[model samples]
Target: MFTRILPAFAAGLLAASPVAADTDIAFALDWRFEGPSAPYFLAIDNGHFEAEGLSVEITAGQGSLDAIPKVASGAFPLGFADINSLVRFLDQNPGAPVTAVMMVYDSPPFSIVGRVSQGISGIGDLEGSVLGAPPPDGAWAQFPILAEVNGIDVSTITIEPVGFPTREPMLAEGNVDAVTGFNFSSYLSLARLGVPEEDITTILFADHGVELYGNAIIVNTDFAAENPEIVTGFLTAVARGWSDAIADPLAAAAAVIERNPAGDQELEGRRLELAIEANVLTDYVRENGMGQIDADRMDRAIEQLRLTYEFTSEPDAALYFTDAYLPDAELRMIAPE
Candidate 1:
């Protein structure tokens, strides 16, 4: 089961990290313009960033790991990406100069999405089936852990290496039994492709045996050092944006609609609502607020990673995340609706 942590570091979090000298921020996103990306747009439209004396430009990325090298190389000072992937990147590169500043997805949406018609309904049905997985997908990277904990032999499942554009299509067309992706992303995508809601089966990793965290706001260490205030302010704005988004998902999707003219408002709105319920509005976030991590759970996540990823060097939690830049608890607290 997914771990729901207590408030261990709330009141003592922020020590007033102010805006950096450079108010202009180049932020990168982990995926394209979708429902989950609404909060950031809300932050921009609502003037939260401007209120904090910061001007932010968010760029869409290819995948979870796509933003890592960009931030590490200083091509972007800030980015959103999978923290698990970040850990591996740090171990592989050693001193890459990028780390997560805010924990956004308390319970990740990683899942194996399938259709009942494909002779699949649960994780048990995976054997003797083809799983369409994008090589760069965050969920595919973590499939080994799910398989290990559940005692499902991965070798029995045929993995079809598919591109992101084709992953959901293959599953919807019955060309593959299932696909590994984020719960909201894949489920909604399949529905968009005319897959019946009754036929789609989403087995979330968090619901199974995985205790991993999800995508987070990452920053270049060099930029953070130079502009601690800017980083803090940016995170504060992000928290506010998410809070507002939770309160009014329809408005949040409206903000997204403005950016992507080709997107369907109704579909995007429903997508935002799904993400809010499944990924964002968690028990821990409701109780302890947002933008921080549970140290004990993080330790467990590292141990779980050891099941598949072999670290080149010892893992350090300090290098991966820091709540020092988070806003004060009062600002971060998300009231339950």
Candidate 2:
């Protein structure tokens, strides 16, 4: 169980009447409707958004970098995306009105998954082996940074650029020794392909050396400034949704299966559990609640990015994220499952 103290103002925000004009919010997700995405759907199914005077419509995204432009272009008022990608996007397209407001994956899922039977087990095992990577994969985009920090000589590895659909299949078929992907997604994909669970080895960049934050709730800065209350209300509802998901992952995945009828309930439930254990409910997040970042860790993450990415402008953490719209502390904490 978890406990929190809520200020009067914060309590008032959460208890705001649903009679207020419902602000239509189109939320763009970073990836397809998988286990991790169930919370947002759970929010809608449970009337959490409606209580906050919000009508949110969620759409699946192609990849980690998919939703940044959508939100910045004003096509979507809000989105979930890789914060690391957002930092680079803002640097390349200066003055683009997009920034992360709530951190979802406190510990990012960027990882290199391998098969033990294929003679690949960890970061160092990739040397002299074929590594399958998708051009737009969030994990692949961060591999250079991971290699630099971990002292893994990327040049020693043969990289085979593969499509998203082919990434897991090629690795499972032993065409590639390993693949860069989310730990939860890739692990489950291999399992469903009939690979023995003991043969799978997940080398999480975060565990080895990567000090980066993962997918975050991004917003159009211009829109957020204009509709501060709406943003706050949206976050409150989201926090509640995530809280529910953490408490009952099976139910959360069931909520997702309701939307995507083809999705396997058991597989998605396991996927959601892995994400919660490895990404979302970290030691820091469990203690401090969610939707905020530690300044020191964020500073280190920025410096780590600078190793591989030459920023056109000086990197400023302020331009990338803000907790201004996060709900109250009580609303943010997800009770231990």
Per-residue CA lDDT of model 2 for 26-49, tens digit only, reads: 788888799999999888999999
Which structure among the candidates has the greatest lDDT?
2
| Residue 276 miss distance in model 1 (angstroms) | 1.3
TM-score of every candidate: 0.93, 0.93
Native-to-model Cα distance after best TM-score fit, residue 335 in candidate 1, in Å: 3.2
Model 1, 97-167: lDDT tens digits are: 89999999899889999999998899999999999999999999999999988999888999999999999
- In candidate 1, stretches whose alpha carbon ends up further than 4 angstroms from where it belongs are 1-22
Per-residue lDDT, model 2, residue 138, is 94
TM-score: model 2 vs. ground truth: 0.93
What are the per-model numbers of colliding residue pairs? 4, 0
lDDT of 2 at 22: 72
